[model samples]
Target: MSSEVVRFEASEEFARRMDAEDSLRSFREEFLFPVHDGEPAIYFVGNSLGLQPRKAKTYVLEALEDWEKLGVEGHFRGTRPWMPYHEMLTEQTARLVGAHPIEVVVMNTLSVNLHLMMVSFYQPTRERPKILMEAGAFPSDQYAVASQVRFHGYDPDKDILRLAPREGEETLRTEDILDTIERHGREIALVLLGNVNYLTGQAFDMAAITRAAHKQGCRVGFDLAHGAGNLQLSLHDDGPDFAVWCSYKYLNGGPGTLGGVFVHERHAHNKALPRFAGWWGHDKQTRFQMGPDFEPIPGAEGWLLSNPPIFQLAALRASLELFDRATMPALRRKSDRLTAYLEFLLDRLPPGVVRITTPRDPKQRGAQLSLRFSKDPRRLLEKLNSAGVHCDFRSPDIIRAAPAPLYNSFHDVYRFVGVLERHARD
Candidate 1:
């Protein structure tokens, strides 16, 4: 159902009716939700860890069986050869992020990829040594950027420029971001941001930020941990120099699974660009020759460090297959409606009971809604969890509930709000 056309109602029957009319509703059966009191709990924390795809077991066991049957030859002779296992994911991953196959690669975890990207893209000249990033970014990103600055013998406190929301504001304004880039473009070596802020659920305008940064001659990148599977991204068109994301969250690749990286096609063949390379990144033909010299692959694959864990690749392949079948455009359409429905229901609660910190504009947010309670937010979170609602709490009184469109229903949103409403009355 188109969000613009449907009139939302605050009733269970209405929620069920919307779910019944949903086109992607059947996709929910593909995942296994957690059980509480012998029924599927309201799993609304896909922003942290996605539910397991049923096919993940099949894919994982297939890889294990291949290893048992083929021994070391499994690398060369399996249903999906272990040696080239990562290749199976390339096309679907590229499609997920709206990048060309050459620009995307599945490799290390999010922080590792971020560090690797910085190694090549965060080159700090004597004049342009500062890194501009959003304040309160995911701690790992902040740490990585700081360490990189220190490695270059620059003081992080002086070289790192942190942009914060205006006083009394929960999210940063696009104009402010662009203006900051414009003002510090010369001193800034890179602009790194989490496209969707984890705590506030604010989705930045990536394309606009990219254009502004490029105009000022600064390298730009994003940490898309929350944006990846939740948002309809156009990394190639958006033209960020690089971007990285974890597969464990919205991507449903299991806990701590492999992450993905996108190095724009413009940077793909730049072999002269300094990078920490490994044998897996060498030309496949020459890799087995045990050559002393490293000849990196021509695209994103060149950044790969070592052979990937085959089991993780298999599990992620299962999820990526579903992503290919469902398509981001379809998922995004449902996501808009699901999130809107959730917002609509939450708004009906008595004012001052809870405040939503996420942007009300759908374009400025994703599926997750960050709720700030007027009092005892942690108590509310505990109450909600014990009541079989699965969500997460951040420090300083915020509970994040993400109704993932792929596996969540309007009924889930309705029930979640019912829980909140009942608890708020207490």
Candidate 2:
């Protein structure tokens, strides 16, 4: 091994032994490995930035080749024409999220789509203008909702209701969430929460929670940024009014790629909803008529504000193809086993220094486990980095490690644990 440094150590033999029996081990070959100073690093950060799929290069090159060969005609006439390009991705993405085709649209960035969905759905009234969300939400979402409240002429400090975990708890519980919804539903205009929390790998009960929120007449939406590729989420069956997710993370799309949105079909036909519109959202057939009368397509496409970034969508297509090959259910099975194995291995470590903050139940979390280190988390993360285990560190004290089923193996988890054990001892 070319060792610039060895901050922590794992037996290569154990790593290989685990890899030998891993059912998902072959998937590691499908991603382009990350190298530091010409040596491939152990990447455990799929929860943050997913490794590039092997097909990504081809997908992006095809788009570029089409652009070169067709010039301006590429918009409508080239191979995989830009027209209806997003549609090429929608069907597979819809399947992954368990949504109907008409209800899902692949477009826009995650936070932008959330804002767009809220623009139409979050109509605060005199008696019920407050919005409800979990505390410790991803920072971008917190900023978005706070800005949304201010934009609507409501004081966010007064109107934004945050549901925090009970005293001495690391994650929110289902019973508590239901209670909070019942208590604030009367005054709440909307409920928007993470499907799988980013900092803590907590997967909320979507169907039951949606029913509860709707019962109290509060509109509900989800920030599925961490949920989409990490779990088998059903946006349609679960009945959230809307949901949004980024493609870059577990979706394995390139960095800062465009994202997808789901607006339940019930709301798609409602032309009365307020929104920020653009020309691309106009009727496809009559769009070139150039008249100011905007007739929207009869689906989620109505909410789209602009033609998509072709290059970004190309990257997404590569990732989606891999998802199709592996399929969500099959991937979820591997995810459960992989995370369980990770947990089992972690359990073997001396407990007090590193306690798992994520739920023990398989159904309540995705492939990720948020391990909380009682000591200085940043310092631990630094040692982890120096050791070449690339899991992400969420601020204060959580290290979020995701054994992404698409490209991670049981051996990776095994190897990571060995390094972590050394870090703990030091």
The per-residue C-alpha lDDT of model 1 at residue 421 equals 90
Alpha carbon lDDT of residue 249, candidate 1? 96
Residue 191 miss distance in model 2 (angstroms): 0.4
List model 1 lDDT by residue over 1-426, tens digit each: 654678888989999999998888988999999898998999999999999999999999999999999999999998888999999899999999999999999998999999999999999989999999989899999999999999999999999999999998989999999999999999999999999999999999999999999999999999999999999999999999999999999999999999999999999889889999899999998899999999999899999999999999999998899889999999999999899989998888898988889999999999999998887888888899999999999997899999998899999999999998998667
TM-score of each: 0.99, 0.94
lDDT of 2 by residue, 283-391 (tens): 8999989988888776788988899999899888988988887888878887887787788778878868789999999999998899887778788888988877788
Clashing pairs in 1: none
Using lDDT as the measure, the top candidate is: 1
> Which regions in candidate 2 have their CA more than 4 angstroms from the true location?
1-24, 36-40
Deviation from native of the Cα of residue 46 in model 2, angstroms: 1.0
